[model samples]
Target: MAIISIANLLASYKSPESKDMWERICKSIGSQMENLPTLEGMRKIVTLSYNHLHYYLKGCIMYLSIFPEDYIITKKRLLKRWIAEGLVAEIRGLTLMEAAEAYYNELLSRNMIARADDPKWTVETCQVHDMVLEVMVSKSLEANFVSLVGGSYEGMSYGSIRRLSIHGGEVVSEGSRSNKIATSHGRKNDIQVMNMEHVRSLSMFGPEDNMKMLDRLGELRLLRVLDLE
Candidate 1:
């Protein structure tokens, strides 16, 4: 399945020679198969696919990092969030929603995300593969695109949090005697004092007990998206 997906992705390059393109695609498949045994290798292939995405599509897909693994995201909801974040731009002949739909379709065609199976979900709804989500999280961190707290991201620190996603965990403030805070997973995470003045979006997922984190909302003077689920 991964091989076929990679082939489809490479085909988008539109080289003049079909035979040459097929040969390159075959080589890429073989390379990916060889590296499939290692997580790092899988990430490399996912990164390769991601690097080929359109610039706008790149940001739109990376935004998926904010979602928890296996979350069923409605197409309409996703598109609206993209528009809210200003990730969707006005195209020559399309409205913002239409352009956003195009971005979603492009990602689907490239096999970057998968359609959700629930009958209740609309045909356009989709979810990211766990592997793809991992790559997105890594890329989002590398670019400082989003600051993810809790879960496996505990103890992580960033210079300036442009966007924040709290995945059901607690963050200890600097005033505390202990820098470590207990996460939902029963792990102690070393929290840090970060600059949130530039934060444009914040999403929190978990129990109301975590509402204590909202005390810092006053610092986010530039916040645009505040989602609590």
Candidate 2:
């Protein structure tokens, strides 16, 4: 007997179309509905919203899938990569970096990413929610947009990787022990460069030998996005 408008329910959503999609998602999970929304239901709603983004926005968001879940992505690092990848369009009155910032803010307003708390870092930091990351990773891989190298693997079997993401602090490829791609917690100062000749975008985390790594950038001739910080 109580009346609650859909607007009140999805007030955070920016568009009416997105709100309608969320309603459809709720109905799709009808019988299973509980006091709290199920993760799958939320997943569908997020995915639907993601699908409605502008192509540029979609590309910018998908690029973050290269980072691991719960990882704090620095705003400077992200915007630089987006600019390098040509994802940020030039605005008449704004610099590329400024345009990139606008894109970042757009994503934030849509609730796709959350700002992180960092006291010392000069640049702002942000992170995606676990649910949003799950969808991003799934869709990114399906589209062959990026390949994440994590943990230990006996053998490497994959086609050409256009974008490569290496997780910091994890030993990658059990059989292939190459320091070139190995990450040391500031214990080692040597930069390790992998033989991903075709990789265009390279993102590394937790690597301290970044200055030395810059010396090897010439190896990746097609490199467009190089995010080491």
Candidate 3:
């Protein structure tokens, strides 16, 4: 039997008032540990503990780093690493590998690891639960960890937009600054120059049609992913 499964069972199988009986039950099953079904493999493993409800919940997320902090964590690798980490609590008759598998399955069953499909599973482009990311970024930002912010929008008084990205067939002109042309209805054209140096990520989609804005972004210098799109 694995220590972690034993740990988990010790952790959940019985309440403090029943620890003695639980340990006795574990000893009886210890020899069969190698063949026992994991919580993940079992059809059901209900919650029995009344304390620290989040022990399992939070534990599921601790290994999230296997995927990029902000990247969509794939189920395959996520499960693989979870197994490799030995984070699973031990059950009397289960191997650590077996226990970790059960723990993973349990997490999936509880929605601790839910649908987190990224854009084509692209690590850099993948995403996660907003609340999860929010919680993560809140802590990260407090530590001054910066991230990517994409696109262009011209708004009132041009607030604090420090970066500007001009993509293929897309143009955002500076108010009366360039003689760029875009024939249209019956209104005089207006442009807005977004701040290009203050925030973090400034991504350009593709096709560098407008080289004029290059200077604006070049000033950013801290640019991360400047795709030509």
By TM-score, who's the top model here? Answer: 1
For model 1, residues 132-198, the per-residue Cα lDDT tens digits are: 8877877787788887776555556666778888776454464431222222213323333666788
Q: lDDT per prediction?
A: 0.75, 0.66, 0.39
User: What RMSD value applies to candidate 1?
Assistant: 6.1
Candidate closest to the true structure, highest lDDT = 1
TM-score of each: 0.81, 0.68, 0.30
Error of 1 at 164 (Å): 0.4
lDDT of 3 by residue, 99-154 (tens): 66666665544333456555566542223443343333233222233221211221
Name the better of 1 and 3 by lDDT. Answer: 1
Question: Model 2 over residues 1-229: C-alpha lDDT tens digits?
Answer: 0011122224445585776867764564453334335655566666766776778899899988888668888888789888988889989999999999999997887777879987876778999887777778667766778665543211223356688775655554434323222221112211242456788987776564455446677778988777675
For model 2, the superposed segments whose C-alpha errors exceed 4 Å read: 1-37, 152-157, 168-195, 206-219
RMSD of each: 6.1, 8.1, 17.1
Instruction: Order the candidates by lDDT, highest first.
Output: 1, 2, 3
